[model samples]
Target chain A: MSGVTGQGPRTDLLAAVEQVRALAAKHAEETDEAARFPVAVLDELRTTGLLGLLVPAEYGGLGGGLDELLDITMELGRADMSVAMIFSMHCQQVAGVVHHAGPRLAGELLPLVAAGRMYLASVTTEAGKGGHLLTATAGLTAEDDGLDIDRFAPIVTGGEYADGFLITMRSPEARSAGDVSLVYAHRDQLTITPSGDWNPLGMRASHSTALRLTGRIPEHQVVGEHGQFRTVVLNTFGPLAHLGWAASWLGTASGALSRVLRLLRSPDGRKGANLDSELLMTRLSRSRQRLETVHALMRHTAEVVTRVRAEGDDLSRPRYQMLINSLKITASEECHRAVEDLIDAVGLRHGYLKGSPTGLERALRDLRSAALNYSNDRLHLADGKLALLDAEVRFA
Target chain B: MDARFTELLTPYLPYLGDRELTADTPLREYGLDSMQAIELMLSVEDTYGVELPDEQLTEETFSTAGKLWDALSGQLGGQGSDTAPAADAV
Candidate 1:
């Protein structure tokens, strides 16, 4: 198939990331301190062509895959976790649009994303689902103009700033919550009632707030085929989001550690004649090893998901999903440990304040969101359930 | 139905229950959703080692066992001349 409307996968990823780092560094402090949207960072991302990095080149994008996205997100995460997260959410939405939607729909939306004129965000959470993403408490009704969707999403990441939002709802002909449908709507088509604030412990710049949305959008905005929401979510959106989340964690932790490494190499740290340079170096090396492991796992999982898409049915298996979920848990925990060790290498006494030499406090706070984003406790339960299934255990 | 087609498709049609599928039986009536349809199609392609053209993947191809058989046979160059448009569709 022809790639989306752009040049082939971007060859200048390094150059683009260098520009993004500058923007991220400029906005990281105030954006996090005020819990504001990283508008400047996003604008720079769009201007630098990094916004369409994951979009197919045929659609005027870079045509890069998960690996390229990971590289960009990790660099962004190193600079600013919030900006990395917002970009990841945008990419996940783009994947749903290009991969699952029919050709005509893809033609309409992908170009806009590819051109950096649009950003997609998903609204899948509901008030009564109790953290279950697969189920929806809302319903869609067929109207004369199109479909009328009125639902309350307790939390929509990037909702306020999104150009388009993909929604999950029970199908119009459904008898139960299991029959779900997904649709995309231009932000102007919906009335989004802000239900809550977004101030949080970490990743404060993501703009994840609760919203009540009521809208009527044209039929063409519906994503995938009707009644295929479960399959599409499992096949496309779920995998992208999971991998993107892991990459974000890896990136942010690495960025914070880089600061600590700088501190270790400074005159203050090395000037002490009796300082245990060997021990500090070893600690930093071990932390780097942990980040490397996280990177490898994320890379391997993305490759597996890509292969499954081409080969079919592999990603849908319960065992494969279990393994992917474990990667999220492992990456989150390992990333936290890496940041902590880097902080120790920087020494706790000097500049131990919030905005310290290494900014370890902020990194730790941001890393905390990884585990709580989907909750490791819930993921472990899912793995336990899969343990009893009769299935082939395979890997890439 | 071709014997190979029957053998490959039967394993995926547990939803058809006790009703034996003939070449005339519409596959969709047995509650085979898109995913299952794709699964059966892929299984046929894998078994016969013939890649079905993307344009041939539609509600029409798998509407009935006969149509699917025709599509597969045509691609495989088997020349099975039972080409009645099986119309109890998906």
Candidate 2:
């Protein structure tokens, strides 16, 4: 509860985020054009100790929660969505460890993470599973004192660069596909072979390439109880992942709108005849309206998650699940729409140019991935099913 | 077993076509996922007009038709006691 809304002064964390934002802005274009990871920005985050932003203070981290995550990711999204996304995904893994790991694992791992010595990546998506996170095709092989797993994930964001991975596999004593376990393995314990290219429409710097991984995971490293990875998914990964992604997308839209506003106020824009056009003003206003709504929803959802965690409420309950799902769906769709409207308002000559002062072109391309990253269509189906169960529809 | 309970669960268990649902039948085998389990819980609550306590909302309670019915009947008080095993049988 203490760090839920970032209660105390977090000037140090915010200041470090500002520094990361500057670094992201500097290398964003080059990173995108080269379709590579934002090395300089991530290096800056490591050196600044911002990598441990979510780790508990007792473990040497800032002990920030979802609120702080939203603030940092939003700022990063404004500068470079890829950087924001990478950071967001990393935080998701850290949250899993924080919330679900046993005492021994927590004692051993959190300190390393808090010390900014480890960067975690997620390996939930499998070769033929699409984006499914609940079930696993790969089963863990029981070793004398641990588990061995060979997993082939079609997309592992920043896989090669991560110091460790949170991998999901079928439980050793599995009854069905849904019986899954989340295992943590350091890079040294795994033979990770990068496969496929990472060239994408946008978010190019995310470097989300396919990876073939085979690793040995000690028993203590298996998160939560055996076959309770679903609990971890529902409680931590699902909510935080959606919240972080939505925040980044919201930031992208907001950054675009700000740039457009700056352009409209410039001398060139003041001299233009369209500046007086009511249509342009209306479009800008509409974009702002959408972005504002998304902003409000993102903050509200983050607060709910923080409160639920503090109060020991079931996050998997129908109402909470629906709220979290709606946040992702609405933020992705609305933020994309806002970016589109801003682009329309800026017009082709400036908006269409890659090097335009408005910077709307890059923002447009980046925001396009917001909907497709996890595929809004899949979420809609899941939410539709959840809706059948959430009979009351309470909003309090 | 209530006919309405089976009727309500049939749609969610597409894998259980042309098969009668027995009390001991494992719901997961017939494709009753976590979401469907919740839907089933709501449908059972609606049909029985009984509000299941938060403590009764658990994976074990919904693991099978019999267990689910046992929990529902417990909420319903004396009725269906013949069908449900003793509350502390496990």
Highest DockQ scorer: 2
Q: What tens digits encode model 2's per-residue C-alpha lDDT throughout B1-90?
A: 576666777787766778888788667656688777776787777777878775556555666787777777777664462464333321
Q: Where is model 1 more than 4 Å wrong at Cα? A: A1-11, A272-282, A349-352, A390-392, B1-90
Task: Report how far residue A270 has shifted in candidate 2, in Å.
Answer: 1.6
Please give the TM-score for the first chain of candidate 1.
Answer: 0.92
Cα lDDT tens digits for candidate 2, A9-88: 26667678888899999999899999999888888888888788889999998788787888888889999989999999
Residue pairs with clashing backbones, model 2: none
Which candidate achieves the best lDDT against the true structure?
A: 2
RMSD of candidates 1 onward, in order: 8.0, 4.3
What TM-score does chain A of each model score against the native chain A? 0.92, 0.96
Per-residue CA lDDT of model 1 for B1-90, tens digit only, reads 555667677776656667777878756544555556766877877877777664455446766787888787777665553743222221
